[model samples]
Target: MGENELAEQFGVTRAGIRAALIDLEAQGLVERIRNRGSRVRVVTVEEAVAITECRMVLEGLCAAKAAVAASDEQLAELTALGRAMTKAVADGEPVTYSDLNRELHARIREFSGRRTAVELLERLNAQLVRHRFQLALRPGRPQRSLKEHLAVIETIEARDPQAAETAVRAHLGSVIEALRG
Candidate 1:
């Protein structure tokens, strides 16, 4: 968005538009080119794969911690989510499955109680929205990921930290492979 055009369209001052764009840029949602103004940032496949590599470690840690730290209530909710996700996939609803996929990861992070990792994962995930959506819509992707996600939930529910971490790592490793493709 051009600063002046956005300001005029939104009835905000130029400074306000500039400030908004600055925040978006900091969040990796927008790219500001000197004279070309700004546009939604495009994350290349290579970059997406690299980001998923980082996510593998953080998410695996979160899964392990969530296995050890999550209460019974949290575990029950995760189980419910897993059931809903399975239904979504069986019903051939990729969009619903994709939304549930995001929720599953976010909830796992929340239950982990690792604030720093959660915050960083949130930032990294925000940048991967387009790529994730694309991957989720691939022919049999949701079905495959459902098994992976259920493995995660099962390990967490069983309170097996090592298994939970391994499940998460394997899930993200699959994601990285998809992104690479």
Candidate 2:
């Protein structure tokens, strides 16, 4: 976008937009062409795969930690969230299911009791938003994802760290496969 457009959108001056664009360019999150203006960088297939793989490992660890650390209240909340997601699936509301899906994962990270991991995961998740939305748009994927989430929640509630880890990895592995396709 043009510097003026970004400035107007963010309520900043053109100079401020330029500075921010320069920073984003340096971070490889945008490309600044002399005449063409800045644009969000497109994620490569390889980058998407790498991000999914990293998420699999990190989220698996989070599930294992959550299995050990989650309290009864937290587990109850997860159960409620799972039920809501189920209803969303049955009602054929992909958008609602997607929102609940994000919340469910965030709660799992919160229950993991690892502040640093949660923060890192948030950053990683921000990078995956576009790809995740694409995956969610796939036909019948939401129901399958809901089942995987239920499995992960069940393993966590059962207090089986190893099983929770395995379940999370499997869930994210399916995501990786979807991304590959």
Question: Candidate 2, residues 47-83: lDDT per residue as tens digits?
Answer: 9889889888899999999999999999999999999
Question: What TM value does model 2 have?
Answer: 0.91
Best by lDDT: 1
TM-score for candidate 1, residues paired by index: 0.96
- Top candidate when judged by TM-score against the true structure: 1
Query: Whole-model lDDT, candidate 1?
Result: 0.95
Model 2 spans > 4 angstroms off: 23-28
Give candidate 2's error at residue 114 in angstroms. Answer: 1.0
lDDT of 1 by residue, 102-126 (tens): 9999999999999999999999999
- Residue 145 error for model 2, in Å? 1.0
Error at 75, model 1, angstroms: 0.4
Q: Give the clashing residue pairs of candidate 2, or none.
A: none
Off by over 4 Å in 1: none
